[model samples]
Target: MGLNIKNETTHELVRRLAALTGQSQTSAVEDAVRRRLAELEQQQSADEEERRRRIRAVIRRAQQLPSTGRTTEEIMDELYDETGMPR
Candidate 1:
Protein backbone atom coordinates (compact mmCIF):
# COMPACT_ATOMS: atom_id res chain seq x y z
CA MET A 1 0.00 0.00 0.00
CA GLY A 2 1.15 3.54 -0.78
CA LEU A 3 1.47 5.72 2.33
CA ASN A 4 1.70 9.35 1.31
CA ILE A 5 2.36 11.58 4.31
CA LYS A 6 1.19 15.13 3.44
CA ASN A 7 1.91 16.91 6.69
CA GLU A 8 5.36 18.56 6.79
CA THR A 9 5.77 18.12 10.56
CA THR A 10 4.79 14.45 10.37
CA HIS A 11 7.22 13.91 7.48
CA GLU A 12 10.00 15.61 9.45
CA LEU A 13 9.21 13.47 12.52
CA VAL A 14 9.29 10.30 10.44
CA ARG A 15 12.64 11.30 8.96
CA ARG A 16 14.08 12.17 12.36
CA LEU A 17 12.83 8.90 13.86
CA ALA A 18 14.29 6.92 10.95
CA ALA A 19 17.65 8.65 11.33
CA LEU A 20 17.72 8.22 15.11
CA THR A 21 16.63 4.54 15.01
CA GLY A 22 18.75 3.69 11.90
CA GLN A 23 15.61 2.36 10.22
CA SER A 24 13.67 3.30 7.09
CA GLN A 25 11.06 6.01 7.33
CA THR A 26 8.33 3.45 6.68
CA SER A 27 9.64 1.22 9.47
CA ALA A 28 9.86 4.14 11.85
CA VAL A 29 6.28 5.20 11.14
CA GLU A 30 5.07 1.62 11.46
CA ASP A 31 6.88 1.16 14.77
CA ALA A 32 5.48 4.44 16.10
CA VAL A 33 1.94 3.53 15.04
CA ARG A 34 2.18 0.07 16.62
CA ARG A 35 3.60 1.46 19.84
CA ARG A 36 0.88 4.12 20.05
CA LEU A 37 -1.81 1.51 19.41
CA ALA A 38 -0.41 -0.66 22.20
CA GLU A 39 -0.29 2.30 24.57
CA LEU A 40 -3.88 3.22 23.75
CA GLU A 41 -5.03 -0.35 24.30
CA GLN A 42 -3.27 -0.45 27.67
CA GLN A 43 -4.87 2.85 28.64
CA GLN A 44 -8.30 1.57 27.64
CA SER A 45 -7.79 -1.55 29.72
CA ALA A 46 -6.76 0.53 32.73
CA ASP A 47 -9.83 2.77 32.27
CA GLU A 48 -12.11 -0.27 32.17
CA GLU A 49 -10.49 -1.64 35.34
CA GLU A 50 -10.95 1.70 37.07
CA ARG A 51 -14.62 1.76 36.02
CA ARG A 52 -15.15 -1.72 37.43
CA ARG A 53 -13.44 -0.75 40.69
CA ARG A 54 -15.73 2.28 41.07
CA ILE A 55 -18.81 0.15 40.39
CA ARG A 56 -17.71 -2.44 42.95
CA ALA A 57 -17.11 0.28 45.53
CA VAL A 58 -20.59 1.68 44.92
CA ILE A 59 -22.12 -1.79 45.30
CA ARG A 60 -20.25 -2.35 48.56
CA ARG A 61 -21.41 0.99 49.95
CA ALA A 62 -25.03 0.25 48.98
CA GLN A 63 -24.79 -3.15 50.64
CA GLN A 64 -23.60 -1.55 53.89
CA LEU A 65 -26.76 0.61 54.14
CA PRO A 66 -29.37 -0.69 56.61
CA SER A 67 -32.17 -2.57 54.90
CA THR A 68 -35.60 -2.12 56.51
CA GLY A 69 -36.87 -5.05 54.39
CA ARG A 70 -39.99 -2.98 53.70
CA THR A 71 -41.81 -3.59 50.42
CA THR A 72 -42.03 -0.76 47.87
CA GLU A 73 -45.72 -0.22 48.57
CA GLU A 74 -45.12 -0.05 52.35
CA ILE A 75 -42.36 2.53 51.92
CA MET A 76 -44.54 4.67 49.64
CA ASP A 77 -47.40 4.49 52.15
CA GLU A 78 -45.14 5.71 54.95
CA LEU A 79 -43.92 8.60 52.84
CA TYR A 80 -47.46 9.60 51.88
CA ASP A 81 -48.58 9.50 55.53
CA GLU A 82 -45.65 11.69 56.57
CA THR A 83 -46.63 14.21 53.82
CA GLY A 84 -50.24 14.25 55.21
CA MET A 85 -51.51 12.90 51.88
CA PRO A 86 -54.87 11.00 51.90
CA ARG A 87 -54.41 7.25 51.49
Candidate 2:
Protein backbone atom coordinates (compact mmCIF):
# COMPACT_ATOMS: atom_id res chain seq x y z
CA MET A 1 0.00 0.00 0.00
CA GLY A 2 1.16 3.51 -0.87
CA LEU A 3 0.43 6.65 1.20
CA ASN A 4 0.71 10.05 -0.42
CA ILE A 5 1.17 13.12 1.79
CA LYS A 6 0.29 16.33 -0.02
CA ASN A 7 1.13 18.88 2.65
CA GLU A 8 4.75 20.10 2.61
CA THR A 9 4.87 20.77 6.38
CA THR A 10 3.40 17.35 7.15
CA HIS A 11 5.84 15.72 4.75
CA GLU A 12 8.73 17.50 6.42
CA LEU A 13 7.53 16.50 9.89
CA VAL A 14 7.22 12.85 8.82
CA ARG A 15 10.68 12.94 7.35
CA ARG A 16 12.11 14.47 10.52
CA LEU A 17 10.30 11.93 12.67
CA ALA A 18 11.68 9.06 10.60
CA ALA A 19 15.20 10.40 10.94
CA LEU A 20 14.89 11.14 14.66
CA THR A 21 13.41 7.70 15.55
CA GLY A 22 15.59 5.73 13.10
CA GLN A 23 12.41 4.27 11.53
CA SER A 24 11.09 4.18 7.95
CA GLN A 25 8.73 6.95 6.82
CA THR A 26 5.74 4.57 6.93
CA SER A 27 6.58 3.40 10.48
CA ALA A 28 7.04 6.98 11.68
CA VAL A 29 3.66 7.99 10.25
CA GLU A 30 1.98 4.95 11.80
CA ASP A 31 3.51 5.64 15.23
CA ALA A 32 2.45 9.30 15.10
CA VAL A 33 -1.12 8.33 14.14
CA ARG A 34 -1.32 5.71 16.89
CA ARG A 35 -0.09 8.19 19.54
CA ARG A 36 -2.62 10.80 18.38
CA LEU A 37 -5.46 8.27 18.53
CA ALA A 38 -4.48 7.28 22.07
CA GLU A 39 -4.44 10.95 23.15
CA LEU A 40 -7.91 11.49 21.65
CA GLU A 41 -9.29 8.43 23.38
CA GLN A 42 -7.89 9.58 26.73
CA GLN A 43 -9.41 13.04 26.27
CA GLN A 44 -12.80 11.53 25.39
CA SER A 45 -12.69 9.27 28.45
CA ALA A 46 -11.90 12.25 30.70
CA ASP A 47 -14.76 14.26 29.16
CA GLU A 48 -17.18 11.40 29.73
CA GLU A 49 -16.06 11.10 33.35
CA GLU A 50 -16.60 14.84 33.93
CA ARG A 51 -20.09 14.61 32.37
CA ARG A 52 -20.99 11.72 34.66
CA ARG A 53 -19.71 13.63 37.70
CA ARG A 54 -21.84 16.67 36.80
CA ILE A 55 -24.93 14.50 36.31
CA ARG A 56 -24.43 12.82 39.67
CA ALA A 57 -24.10 16.23 41.38
CA VAL A 58 -27.33 17.42 39.71
CA ILE A 59 -29.16 14.28 40.87
CA ARG A 60 -27.90 14.80 44.42
CA ARG A 61 -29.11 18.41 44.45
CA ALA A 62 -32.52 17.42 43.05
CA GLN A 63 -32.89 14.80 45.78
CA GLN A 64 -32.17 17.44 48.41
CA LEU A 65 -35.11 19.63 47.27
CA PRO A 66 -38.27 19.63 49.35
CA SER A 67 -41.01 17.39 47.93
CA THR A 68 -44.45 18.89 47.21
CA GLY A 69 -47.34 16.99 48.80
CA ARG A 70 -49.39 17.38 45.57
CA THR A 71 -50.69 14.25 43.85
CA THR A 72 -49.42 13.27 40.38
CA GLU A 73 -52.61 14.54 38.72
CA GLU A 74 -52.34 17.90 40.53
CA ILE A 75 -48.68 18.27 39.51
CA MET A 76 -49.51 17.50 35.88
CA ASP A 77 -52.34 20.08 35.90
CA GLU A 78 -50.01 22.74 37.33
CA LEU A 79 -47.36 22.00 34.70
CA TYR A 80 -49.97 22.14 31.91
CA ASP A 81 -51.22 25.56 33.03
CA GLU A 82 -47.65 26.89 33.36
CA THR A 83 -46.95 25.81 29.76
CA GLY A 84 -50.33 27.30 28.57
CA MET A 85 -51.44 23.95 27.18
CA PRO A 86 -54.95 23.78 25.74
CA ARG A 87 -57.59 21.97 27.82
Candidate 3:
Protein backbone atom coordinates (compact mmCIF):
# COMPACT_ATOMS: atom_id res chain seq x y z
CA MET A 1 0.00 0.00 0.00
CA GLY A 2 3.02 2.29 0.58
CA LEU A 3 6.76 2.61 -0.03
CA ASN A 4 9.46 4.48 1.88
CA ILE A 5 12.31 5.88 -0.21
CA LYS A 6 15.17 6.79 2.12
CA ASN A 7 17.41 8.39 -0.50
CA GLU A 8 16.87 12.09 -0.95
CA THR A 9 18.04 12.01 -4.60
CA THR A 10 15.61 9.21 -5.43
CA HIS A 11 12.81 11.06 -3.64
CA GLU A 12 13.61 14.23 -5.56
CA LEU A 13 13.61 12.33 -8.88
CA VAL A 14 10.18 10.84 -8.09
CA ARG A 15 8.89 14.31 -7.13
CA ARG A 16 10.30 15.75 -10.34
CA LEU A 17 8.67 13.01 -12.43
CA ALA A 18 5.37 13.55 -10.64
CA ALA A 19 5.47 17.29 -11.29
CA LEU A 20 6.63 17.00 -14.88
CA THR A 21 4.00 14.39 -15.81
CA GLY A 22 1.24 15.84 -13.58
CA GLN A 23 0.91 12.44 -11.93
CA SER A 24 0.91 11.44 -8.26
CA GLN A 25 4.25 10.33 -6.83
CA THR A 26 2.90 6.85 -6.40
CA SER A 27 1.74 6.77 -10.03
CA ALA A 28 5.15 7.92 -11.24
CA VAL A 29 6.99 5.30 -9.26
CA GLU A 30 4.46 2.66 -10.17
CA ASP A 31 4.78 3.45 -13.87
CA ALA A 32 8.56 3.40 -13.75
CA VAL A 33 8.66 0.13 -11.79
CA ARG A 34 5.97 -1.50 -13.92
CA ARG A 35 7.67 -0.60 -17.20
CA ARG A 36 11.05 -1.88 -15.98
CA LEU A 37 9.51 -5.06 -14.55
CA ALA A 38 7.73 -5.77 -17.80
CA GLU A 39 10.93 -5.27 -19.72
CA LEU A 40 12.79 -7.62 -17.39
CA GLU A 41 10.14 -10.31 -17.45
CA GLN A 42 9.61 -10.11 -21.22
CA GLN A 43 13.36 -10.09 -22.05
CA GLN A 44 13.16 -6.77 -23.88
CA SER A 45 16.80 -5.87 -23.16
CA ALA A 46 19.58 -5.45 -25.73
CA ASP A 47 21.10 -8.83 -24.91
CA GLU A 48 17.81 -10.56 -25.52
CA GLU A 49 17.42 -8.72 -28.80
CA GLU A 50 20.89 -9.77 -29.91
CA ARG A 51 20.23 -13.37 -28.90
CA ARG A 52 17.01 -13.40 -30.90
CA ARG A 53 18.85 -11.91 -33.85
CA ARG A 54 21.47 -14.64 -33.69
CA ILE A 55 18.78 -17.33 -33.51
CA ARG A 56 17.00 -15.85 -36.50
CA ALA A 57 20.24 -15.79 -38.44
CA VAL A 58 20.80 -19.45 -37.62
CA ILE A 59 17.27 -20.31 -38.74
CA ARG A 60 17.76 -18.39 -41.98
CA ARG A 61 21.04 -20.15 -42.67
CA ALA A 62 19.49 -23.54 -41.96
CA GLN A 63 16.60 -22.82 -44.30
CA GLN A 64 19.01 -21.86 -47.05
CA LEU A 65 20.72 -25.26 -46.91
CA PRO A 66 20.20 -27.57 -49.91
CA SER A 67 17.66 -30.34 -49.46
CA THR A 68 18.29 -33.94 -50.37
CA GLY A 69 15.57 -35.79 -52.27
CA ARG A 70 16.55 -38.99 -50.43
CA THR A 71 15.54 -39.52 -46.83
CA THR A 72 17.86 -40.84 -44.08
CA GLU A 73 16.32 -44.29 -44.43
CA GLU A 74 17.12 -44.33 -48.14
CA ILE A 75 20.72 -43.41 -47.44
CA MET A 76 20.96 -46.16 -44.83
CA ASP A 77 19.62 -48.65 -47.34
CA GLU A 78 22.42 -47.73 -49.70
CA LEU A 79 25.12 -48.08 -47.03
CA TYR A 80 23.75 -51.13 -45.19
CA ASP A 81 21.34 -54.05 -45.69
CA GLU A 82 18.71 -55.65 -43.43
CA THR A 83 21.47 -57.47 -41.49
CA GLY A 84 23.02 -54.08 -40.51
CA MET A 85 26.19 -54.87 -42.44
CA PRO A 86 27.78 -52.56 -44.98
CA ARG A 87 26.67 -53.33 -48.54
Best by TM-score: 2
Q: Which of 1 and 2 is ahead in TM-score?
A: 2
Against the true structure, candidate 1 reaches a TM-score of 0.78
Score every model by TM-score. 0.78, 0.84, 0.49
How big is the RMSD of model 1?
Answer: 5.1
Q: What's the residue-level lDDT of 67 in candidate 2?
A: 89
RMSD each, Å? 5.1, 2.8, 6.5
Name the runs in model 2 displaced over 4 angstroms: 81-87
Clashing residue pairs in candidate 1 (N, C-alpha, C atoms within 3 angstroms): none
User: What is the number of backbone collisions in each predicted candidate, taken in the order shown?
Assistant: 0, 0, 0
lDDT of 1 by residue, 41-84 (tens): 99999999999999999999999999999998898887788666
Q: Which parts of model 3 have CA positions greater than 4 angstroms off? A: 44-87
> Over the stretch 1-87, how does candidate 3's per-residue lDDT look in tens digits?
767679999999999999999999999999999998998878767778899999999999999999988998999999999999999
Off by over 4 Å in 1: 72-87
lDDT (Cα) of model 3: 0.92
The TM-score ranking, best first, is: 2, 1, 3
lDDT of 1 at 71: 93
